[model samples]
Target: MMSKENYEYAKTLYEKWGIDVEEVLGKLRNIPISIHCWQGDDIGGFEVNRQELSGGIDVTGNYPGKATTPEELRSDLEKALSLIPGQHRVNLHAIYAETDGEVVDRDEIEPKHFANWVNWAKEQGLGLDFNPTLFSHEKAEDGLTLSHPNKDIRDFWIRHTIASRKIAEYMGKELGSPTLTNVWIPDGYKDIPSDRLTPRKRLKESLDEVFSVEIDEKYNVDAVESKLFGIGSEAYVVGSHEFYMGYALKNNKLCLLDSGHYHPTEVISNKISSMLLYSDQLALHVSRPVRWDSDHVVILDDELREIGLEIVRNDAIDKVRIGLDFFDASINRVAAWTIGTRNMIKALLYAMLTPNEYLKQLQEEGNFTERLALMEELKTYPFGAIWDHYCDEMGVPVRENWLDEVKEYEETVLSKRK
Candidate 1:
């Protein structure tokens, strides 16, 4: 059947459940998923004095055509964005700063360093997000930053984070969208710490100083990300969930929850509602965790769907800032971004299409059987047809047809990188 025909048929089914298909598509188009730039280069930024990946961050496989320069990374990102539907923001790290081959340390990074990125973003009509590069540096080789025993080390990271927020402020002021500047540091111990309180105390003080600089919230919003455990910090992570949860709640900061940054059994989907109750707004770093925080490409799994459901049902779309965080060098890097981003958007669409109010009524009225049955049946609904129409309307390839373009690009553009 033609796309419009199939869409018309699917629209009827969804409308029966009180879902406005047209409205849903409109809302989905406006929900921008911040696509991370690290995926193109395997977290390897274009630093003049680049360091090896550290702080529990690792990218497997030796994929050819990894973006080696700022221009190449942006070009690869452009290609990926072309294949993906919807206008999205690009999430960047301080390390991705282009300083014209100058050795600009993290602490010294300025908004001018990202002039190219800001200009490109303006041309592409995309928003921008930022993160401070706290790991993979000599000061953080011990896996301690912001909470380092050495005051100088902690001060260095603090300066870097402040600089990052300033850069984000500049992007937001120029782009007319608030830029989320997230801070995730690798600061913990390899073995059992004699005392954890001191490190956390230091971190809290550092954060206070950083936020004291006072960038307007209209331009830049800050978030602090926590981790359960890292390669070197297996025994104890100072910025554990409990620590950051309290800090964020008290300090009025967004506690960024990375899907992969939790224990094996703990799922971030369950935490979204609880976090929203306390924080006016929150952020997410959506990624797939196979066994550990491996940073695999996101798949449309039950958790992803549940996350979408929570966000939609609670009407926290504006309250929650969503960003993708995964890098898989095993597959085509562009394909990785496309797959993960498309899945994230698909998850949101799935949630929007759901009869959430009806489900809530069912649960409230003790209609578990009907609710379960309806949920299961909805899974087999003509969602794929609706998705296809969305792509058709949005002028992007429908279904897996995007893979063909990736293959052609790989052969024509990626293969020639070396």
Candidate 2:
């Protein structure tokens, strides 16, 4: 654990760089990272006779402690949240609906299906974000959902997206915070298609219908996510970044940029400034992709740090909505949550501690050598000590102590799930 005197000394070190450590910690506390619920259950939703992870989605391992029921999933989430500092939100997919033994099709789902989730989030004092599950269904087996050539199939997805928005609206109203309804359809072709324009055209039309019913902005805000490619949709994706960017701009909706949704060489940290130039608000699905869109656990890597810098230095924290989106069943599920969540918090703090003004002055004055030198010098600052203090203040175990708690949780709660 970090001692108060040591934290004060580290604070004074940062103070020399003209950074207010205490103020940054206060700001960090308010920025909530919406943790995905799918991570707790390995994305195996509770829908009856659920289709195999299709439409480019695949869960690699059969982890023994995977949450089998709603009770187990929420319980696991509680354990993860306990270890993580800051009041975070929960992100849910449409397939995670609780139907009370009644079969609820994707299109027929309502806010009632998620009443229990809303109540639980309320109990935790957390907000809820939502996504429409467009894959893992017979309707989407052909590697298309909203962009299907068949009008019936496309209409089915449209109805489903509309229903998801309504459900999100209900959550926002009940919780008194606007729920972000993000739409990400797995609509594309496995092989190169001759008629690419037609699919995008159909997708635009379907999205128009899905967003036609104007839900109150206070209750629900809409966002469209784009993708580079998926396992099945390798050749062409109907909802490409360009397609969604144009749609989001023209329709006055928030644009979502998943870090792992683009080419591995491309980093979303650079795109944040460009997106904010046009859109007032943007949503981010932060995940680490090792090579492809393989939602790996997030860490305090270069891109994650750059993303934090982009948001903090530009003062776009309020404009951007941060959410986690990755599932790794190869390890303890709750620990995966804790590891990723803490790293995210760490990245933000690292960025917050940077002396943005001095760095900008160096760049503006064309002192490139010193700018580079100072940048490297800033890396060695005692940000870890500050982070430990933040964890202590939030009542979470500092450093590796959280891991022991997770191991204990695995023994008590998760081990009994099976």
Candidate 3:
């Protein structure tokens, strides 16, 4: 941990750059990152008679200690949340609703099915967010759901999404916070389709029906997600970025920007500003896209830093909802959550500690030379000392100490899961 004297010295250094070190630390600590629950089980929910994930999504590894039940998943999530720095939220897919070993179809899911989760969140003092599971089912076997040509399939998926919104609202009302239930359909073809426009039309219509019964925005905030392509939907995806961007704009819904949903070269940091301008609110599904939407664990890299900077620099913290979305079963599941969530917090701290006022002024004055030079110089400032101090203040382990807690957890808790 950084010493008190060193922290004060670092504070003075950031003060020179017009940054308030204590204010920055408190703000970063207060901002909550919604930690996705699927990371605990690699998206394999506790559904009985579950089939292998078929519709475009895929998990890469067979690491041990994957949570197989709702209890285990919640336990793992609790362990992960322990090492993270802030009081965070939990994100859930509808497929994760506790069915009590009953065969509940996606379309039949109710708020009662997720009552345990709501209570758990309340007990933990965490907020809840949601997603409708539109993939990996018999109806989705053809690699389509909401946009499927068969009206029956489309209606089924639409009903499921409507029900999901209700469940999200119930959770939110019960927990005294709004739940953001995002809709992302894996509805497209592996090969190039001759009539791509028809499926997109079907998707738009289905979304209209799904949002027709407007739940109170304070209880349930609906967001739409789009993807470039998935494994089976490589040739064309019905819910393209353009499609949902247009939908979100027209319907007055939040647009979800998953960091991994775009091409490798496209970073969401570049899109956050635009998304915030048109939508009443913005939702982010943070992940790392390797060559494609690989769903890799997030790290404290340049793109992550830029994402944090974008949100903070634009003064959109309250307008933007932050969430982590990655499933890495190659390593310890609990550790994966802890590492990714912590890195995300780290990035936000880096952005919070930045002196954006001077940079923005330089740009506005058309002083490109000083702006460029100062940008590079600010990269080497004492960010680590501030981060270390922040972590210490938050009561999370500072430096490499959190990793040891995770390792010890694996040895004591995760290793015996098998």
The list of candidate 1 runs beyond 4 A from truth reads none
Candidates sorted by lDDT, best first: 1, 2, 3
TM-score of predicted structure 3:
0.98
Predictions ranked by TM-score, top down?
Answer: 1, 2, 3
Give Cα distance to truth, residue 178, candidate 2, Å.
Answer: 0.7
Best by lDDT: 1
Residue-level lDDT of model 1, residues 90-179, one tens digit each, is: 999999999898999999999999999999999999999999999999999889999998999999999999999999999999999999
Selected candidate, larger lDDT, 2 vs 3: 2
TM-score of 2: 0.99
TM-score of each: 0.99, 0.99, 0.98
Candidate 1: pairs in clash: none
Instruction: Kindly list the per-residue Cα lDDT of model 3 for residues 358-395, writing each as its tens digit.
Output: 89999999999999999898898878888788778877
In candidate 3, where is summed lDDT lowest over 10 consecutive residues?
A: 1-10
lDDT of 2 by residue, 1-418 (tens): 5788878888999999888888999999999999999998878888976778888886666667888898888988998999988998999999999888887799999999999999999998999999999988989888889988899999899999999999999999999999999999888888898988998998999999999998999999999999999998899999999999999999999999999999889999999999999989999999999889889899889999999999988889999999999989888888889899989989889999999888999899999999999889889887888989999999999989998888887787777765
RMSD of 2: 0.9
Off by over 4 Å in 2: none
* True-vs-predicted CA distance for residue 344, candidate 1, Å: 0.6
